[model samples]
Target: MLLLNNHTMKSKIEKSTFIVKLTAVLVVLMISIISCNKELTDRKDFSNNTGGNVIDAQQQKVLYVIVDGARGESVFKSSTPNLSKMIKNGMFTINAVSDENGLSATSWADMLTGVDKTKHKVISEDFSNNKLTDYPMFFKRVKDNTSLRTAAFSISPALSTKLVTHADVNTSLPNDEAVKTATLAELANNNAAVVLAEFQGVDKAGAQYGYDASVPQYAAAITNIDTYIGELNTAIKARPNFSKENWLIVIASNKGGDYPVIPALMDQTLYSKPLLNGFVILYNPNFKSTIYNKPANLNSLPYLGSYGKLNGDTIASVDAAKSNLYNFGTTGEYTVEFKLKVQSFGTLNAPIFFKTSSPANAATGWWIIHNGSNGTWRLGGLASAAISTPTTKAMEVNQWYNIGFKIYFVGTVRYVQLYQDGDPIGSPTVITGRTVNNSEPLVAGYRSGFGNSATQFITDIRIFNAAVPDAVIKDFACQVLLDSRHPNYNNLIGYWPALDGAGTLIKDQSKSKNDFVFQKSTQWLSFEDYDNKFCIKPTPELYKIVPRGIDIPRFILGWLNINATGFNLDGKVWTPIYTNILK
Candidate 1:
């Protein structure tokens, strides 16, 4: 009976194992089928819009479409079969930016003249003080080189009247439909070398509703324009000589629309600004697919946590055996540095970091305070509230800054100097009769009646036992992570990265092990590592290299094999593919 039972159990176990293996195989097969279906769907879509394979002997023609106020990300997210087809077949970038000036005329001038707003000066909608005559429209450049006819049809009358110079046929229409009709007719009958059609309905829809894909009207408007684009493609294909023509179809948006503040888009970089976002698609059947993404932000710090507003919120050091190592006496030289972001500057002096529990006039502690009235910070000693001169550059609100102070002596003359980023904020001041040594734990923030709702963020607090050299201070002030490369790495008495994603205690990575204990619950915040160097907006020079509205003219000129050498255009050509096509 026992032998029979054992044989039966082994058989049951084998059957169970076989069932489990079968289930696993079925799940993998289902996943593989789903993935293959998606790939096949994509391939089918691409095949339907191939526009025929490229022919080496085909004539090169240009068709550029401009959709006003269409945010790049929104357009990418929208369901547009026509745009998607082109995107899969050619070079594209949803991360393209508009003009830094953020005006329609500024963008138009950049697109037509191959230069930035600083050169063309078309800063407003009215086109009051523009230097377009010096850097005339690309149509004029094309006309000067070759006798090829160029035409432009714009929904905005101002574009035709003020900006569309040197065109063989410049027609100003009232609506997108009319502009599309005119452009289609021009493409059908005329042998135009370059054709430009500007549609304004997208911008109008965005202005009324919103600029996001979630907004029905905005998405519908983009889709409607996508249908018009499909019709235009059909017209181009219907041309009698279409089989012998190589069309470079370019589609882009002038700028993105402004909307309510979105927390997700609040990355501390120019790319975070909605008004600066746009799209660019340079399509040709012969071109290989090349999609550009947002450039990697080289100089950015990861935002980890938010303890609270600086009004009364404080993160103090725990009472450890080596807590007194941070106390810098009048005779002892030391450096205290941290990253700060002030939300608002109130009337009262903001005490960023101090060693004393009660920091007052003639107190035996040193402190760094920001004067709200003059927009400058000063190093304070015990005898007086301020020791060093006020910084020339006032600290701006809602911006990340690396600020600290160094206390050193010049042959018995103890001096305190305030530093911003890696450079000195103001001239050093002589410290006369002040002792910064105290028994109280080193405090990061304190209650100064800074005003209701006046808050600040503090992190990456580093306190050194010795005064670091100026070069060393400058080198590591903007550094996000603490490493052994620092010359004063061994002199670090207290170092709190404050990046512990959770918990009330901020662990100190230094050898002293003096941790910071938050008084209240940890209020943590997160951020994408954005380039703080170009926090708000990139300079026009930086925008020149990226895919922007300004590059459209230069790109067109390159496609036409025209040498824009002496044009002195600020915009550079984005030659991703077809390098041999450009002169």
Candidate 2:
């Protein structure tokens, strides 16, 4: 009976082992099938949109216009009839803000490459490095993919020289008259995919003369560009191909100049304003919606856990582990909640603050909210409170605190409400007496009251179009932080860079410039001998005299020792011209 029982156990164990092996094989097969399916799906999606091995349909006719040194306010004020019509029909970002540096090469390069200057490495005018050729430009990438024709006409020498190099046909014209002629010719050809025209006479005039003198020229240039744009539109409307083919017209600026130096005109703070510097217009006949939100928009209240150390120079250290949601809808309400997992509590305790680009125009206007970590919240204009304290009792490190706030726009006025955890901290803070409306970008983070490093780990950031109720906020907080059962609980978007292969620098072996340089073989040939054989040339007389119709130089013959027992000057061992030899 014992022997029979032992045999039965052994048989069950064998069956279990077989089942495990089968399961492993099935899992591998499933994974392989899923991967193949994903590839097929991607291919199908691309084919449906791009016409399956055909070129991009929308790139058939594209017009790009750059208005050099036109301020955002000036763009709005000026009577650009054609541009106005485009704006009315197309989409525009009223509160668009650029980098703080305002360098022309940097911004223009950003627009063309779709990458910021931080990545492109094109910072200033004096940057003359050949590194710009390392990354493919927009035109270069598009040109490689399609057979579309391209052209550019520009007034600014810098724009004409640097930006136009990637295009197929480019003309560096000085004025609008020349630009109009070139543009008309390119449009008439019916083969142009992109026609870019840049007008810079206004900026040039401003630099030479005063701002007042340049204003008229700027206006005249605008009028001319508008008239020509209208003419082009009319021409396109007349063409039968316009209905069938897709086209996009983009108008923008490189940078805006100051009026104080050029002319003692109205002291319009172009530098202080955000959107005043530049704007982008997208005109597509097939455009379904005028406004298309960028994939990763700026969060209404972006949180920076540790924004630089107390004495450090770093402005803010963003937590790449947190979800940053950018709201694209116009002038709505938003709320952000974050838990501060304090490691150590010390003096200099203050509530987390909120800031926006409203008061100081798009360039400035950093409004703030006070002591958001605690129950009491304060909302004030830029730089109103001290973040440091002598006592360490207020903030105890290693303690967790909940902070949240609400921001809503009432017509042109924006209101703020502060909350600590689930409780309302104080009265609704109203920022009033504004010359302008709420058309600025919003940012949020911890403030030391002064400039101090915010050393706190924040989690559970949520944004809403309308005001979120206390119950919903509590549920979201519990779902994300307490219970950890939120659908997107891991903040997956924040960690996407690691998954999608973006955070790491991928080495491209196909790029010849990036290929490894192997050391020259020292055994085969010395550097001096290689140079002499390749760099030195034989005389015509020496070239004509050889056994196998090959040249045998006297110097080389002496060096080679033709008289030696092993040496011969026949077909087997004839002196060959190094220049004629290909490596």
Candidate 3:
């Protein structure tokens, strides 16, 4: 669905460009409005400007809870009524991320230190050689700036011992129940301005069983934490100064466990890693519901299809009748293109794609082949002919490359052009007198004697009757799948994606209906096209809106109306709700 046709895609880009320009102007106006009203009263009015509740910074308290290994998808699937209520009353997102490293030590530091693993150096469980002193926990920031009472409760002793520095009351308990009991006790008796707690039951359950909601133990553990959350919320509400206090309840996961997500939930990027998947909720009575959902990207269709890894043992071919139009005779003009990733340099003159009875230079045929001399490809035909030429540049192994060639006639003069990634490889070589037409079927992957030692991957075969222009080839070189954007769309006589996933017949998408049939067992391969160089930008809808653990400290600072710029924190405020509150 993300692969819109050329016209639709162009229209979308134009509209998106205008909206971005408009958003830029609006952002300037919003900044001006914020700067003009720097007072707390004016900021409070600004919070309610969009009809949200009036929130006083002085009365704000935070109860930030971190649950380990709670996959956001699993949490969404589980029955957590308490969390659902908070989601309705908060700025929340199921598509939030943790530190990419996905280690407890790393994400814990990310949540507490307001920085990534690269800055904090807490990449392992032992907390060895960390830079915690330079970027100490947020509790230290609060202690240095204000006299506010801060408390930290955790089931992991290392968190209380290693990371929870400068908290007025820091305690490590044995289990989730003990942690919850101590947190409930603190809320009932003490008036802590910030209370941070960590629970480990979900992570423990995930480690024992699995991280999916289908696992009874994992689902039960999540519901159990929800129960504890319910109890904690009850205690907070029962406080004597409840009506006067404005509380910000923050619930989040340090990281997700190692489990494959369902296809429906897969983002098909680095963000789709199970360990990087987590959730964040910044709940307050005054805030309006704002949820950041997963955005659709250009990878929505995901170039997921069958690829061929020819290791000298497999060959695919089209019948001569079906492949006759593909042969560039003395008079005809044609183009051939395909994607290739060389696993290793093959035998001297390995036939990658050819249309002939023999692959010898003296044979009356043409081939797109690997030249063992310089680890590059060359055009092969009758010996000492213009149709035989080697590419100037060598191709690297294990990297995807778009390889193409076109033969056309300008007046009575004929020329053969080579292309690598859609750019002409040197200048065109004249082959006016060379005749490469053959009666043999068009063959790929293997031919007698020339392909036995070859190893490479091949897919997305395209054959056009018209000699395509250089501009059009370069424009669609990185395209994973062809569409109407191609100027020679109607001229394609053969188009085999070679991605049937499980079949001997490589389906043809072109109007000519010429399909390539495998002569032997095809070595089908699977890969993700997430790293396509063509459409590299992520979809704009939720680009930077998804929250992260590093943002927790900045969120706290913003809620408390504290200036975070002086702290040199490496995080942004979690939501736009706190934008006007930041000094």
Task: Provide the clashing-pair count of each candidate structure.
Answer: 0, 18, 1
lDDT of 2 by residue, 379-490 (tens): 4442233222212223445444455566666677765665555555555655434221233323333343343334443334344445666665555543322223433333
Q: What stretches of model 1 exceed 4 Å from their correct place? A: 1-56, 296-430, 433-546, 578-583
What's model 3's lDDT at 269?
61
Off by over 4 Å in 2: 1-59, 205-220, 259-271, 274-276, 288-583
My TM-score estimates for the predictions, one after another, are 0.55, 0.42, 0.55
Error of 2 at 245 (Å): 1.8
For candidate 3, write residues 320-358 as lDDT tens digits: 977778667778788889988777776576778888787
CA lDDT, every prediction? 0.74, 0.45, 0.78
Ranking by lDDT: 3, 1, 2
Best by lDDT: 3
How many backbone clashes are present in model 1?
A: 0
